[model samples]
Every structure is written in C-alpha cells, then in structure tokens.
Target: MARSRSRSFITTEKPTTYDEDQFALPNLNSNWVYYKGAWLVHIILIICVKILLSSVPGVSSETSWTLTNLSYMLGSFVMFHWVKGVPFDFNSGAYDGLTLWEQIDNGAQFTPAKKYLTALPIGLFLLSTHYTHYDAITFLVNFTFLAVVIIAKLPQLHKVRLFGINRLEVE
Candidate 1:
C-alpha cells in the first residue's frame, strides 16, 4: 500500500499597507559626526594609556598582566564607543537599541564583529593578569586615567551644545 503525501498548506496574505509604508519611508537625518568624533576620542585615549603605561616603571610580571588587562579593557571600551555610534533610534534611557547587524538591511551595519573582536583581547588579558606577575597600582593609575578621560568626554560630546556659548567668557 502506497501512502499519499498530505498537501495541506496555509498561506496568509501579507497586509497591503505594509508595502506602501515601506516605499514612502521617512527621511532620517542621523548625525554621524558624533560617531566619528567618538572614534577619535577612543583612539586618543588608547594612545595616551599606552604612553602612560610605558612611562611608569617597577612593574612585576603580575603588574604587567594588569597593564595588559587594562589594554584589553580599553580596547573593548573603544569598540563599544564605536558600536554605540552606529545609527539607530534610541530612547531617552528607556529602551535598548537594535544590534548593528539587525539594521544591516536598512543600509547600516557595524563593519566588524565587536563582541569577539573586543572580547578575545579581554580574555587573554584576564588570563595573563590572573596568572602572571606585575604593580597593581601602576595598572590602576593608568586604567583609571583612561576611564576618566573616556567617561568625561561622553557628556561633552553628546549632551552639551556649545554652539552659541563663547569659550573665552568665564562662567
């Protein structure tokens, strides 16, 4: 006895208004200037941290690990900054934005896979810092400085509008 294959299939029609709405898209004048600016800020911080690390001395192998870990943290920070810059609708600390790749169909996607690209360094640094010998204080200072610089810049870069205010005038 030969059994016949079932031919039951349901195909729901898509809403007609969907295509119309998609075609008549709203214009989004996203300001990417801030994104690039953030990138520059990260780059500068990375360099400065490296410089400060090199200048400080009397580092044990463990302290060296800490320094390396600091580097990993800094690199992750830079990547995060860059990722944040990618254009997406953001709520005022209310809702999370979509992932970079999710917005790729809209002609936007972060160039690199930031998760692993940034994570590997962090993992290696952690391993080295944990097992190897190096000065906790030296690493602390350098890492703290880097963090302070990066964090301080965020408000100035994103929130503060200084277009009309004169820098020369003392407030």
Candidate 2:
C-alpha cells in the first residue's frame, strides 16, 4: 500500500510594530543650512542667466537687465515662500507631514507682519541686483558661489553631511 503525505497550513513570518521614536525631530540647524545653501544657489543661477541674457548680441542690455532683475525678484519671492513650506523629514516639533499648501488649506494662519518679514530678504536682494554693476569678475564670483552651493546641496553628499536628510522619504 502507498503512504499519504500531510499538508502544512502555518506560516513562519512575524509582523513588526512601528517605533515612534524612530521619527525624531529633525535638526533645526541642518534645516537652516540647507535652506541658506539652496537660496544662494538660486541667486547665483539668476545672476548667471541675467549675464547670459545681457550678452546676447541683438538684445538691448538695459532692457535685458531690467527684465532679468524683475524676473529674479519675482522668483526669489516665490521660492522663498515655497522652500519655507517644505516639511523637514524628521518631526520638527512644528508641524510634520504637511506641505505649505496643506497647512494653508487646513487654516494654519500667518500675520501680515510675518509675511513682510519673510519677504524682506528678497526685497533687499532685488535692490542689490538693481544697483550693482554686472562686470566679468562679478559674474565669475556668482558662478563660483553657485557651483559651491550645488556641491553642498548634492543629494547623496548632503545626506552624509550635517543636513542629514532634507527631504522626507515617502514609502
């Protein structure tokens, strides 16, 4: 007679619990460092683009410079607010897991004074750009600064440095 085999129904894997402590507050210093670095990089890019636009053979230098500065000012304003809104990956005591838009939608409020204070740097930078003469040395300095900023902000490299992870890893 042939022998019969038995089938098994139990599994070996175990479920794991989520650890709340794993989500610590992000380093505020690191956040500021990233924010400042990104801002500098953006400014350098704007300056370089302005230089290129001014150098175009057929374009009027005055008009080009004016347009570039105007655009840069507007971009600075927008970027400043946008970056301010990005949530740091680690819980930062403030708000976690909420974008700026989400905060606005949820009725998180800001005062007029607060808004003006945030925009102050942008206004100052616009004035500086308008008043400064764009020479070759100035262009070179801006480009060099921008290049340094880019290196500092490189995703892989930055993760290893003080900034720890500037962005949240979803999933």
Question: What number of clashing residue pairs does each candidate have, in the order they appear?
Answer: 8, 0
- In the range 98-163, model 2's lDDT, one tens digit per residue, is 223223312223433234333443453445456666576654544444344334323233112232
User: What is the Cα-based TM-score of model 1?
Assistant: 0.30
Winning candidate number (TM-score): 2
**Model-by-model lDDT, in order?**
0.39, 0.40
**Candidate 2 backbone collisions, by pair:** none
Q: Residue 73 deviation, candidate 2, in Å?
A: 1.6
Model 1 worst lDDT run, 10 consecutive residues? 93-102
The reply for model 2, stretches above 4 Å from the true place, is: 1-24, 27-43, 82-84, 87-171
Clashing pairs in 1: 60-134, 61-133, 61-134, 62-133, 62-134, 63-134, 63-135, 64-134
* TM-score for each predicted model, relative to the true structure: 0.30, 0.35
167 Cα displacement, candidate 1 (Å) = 28
Candidate 1 Cα errors over 4 Å, as ranges? 1-56, 81-83, 86-115, 130-171
Model 2 lDDT-worst window of ten? 10-19
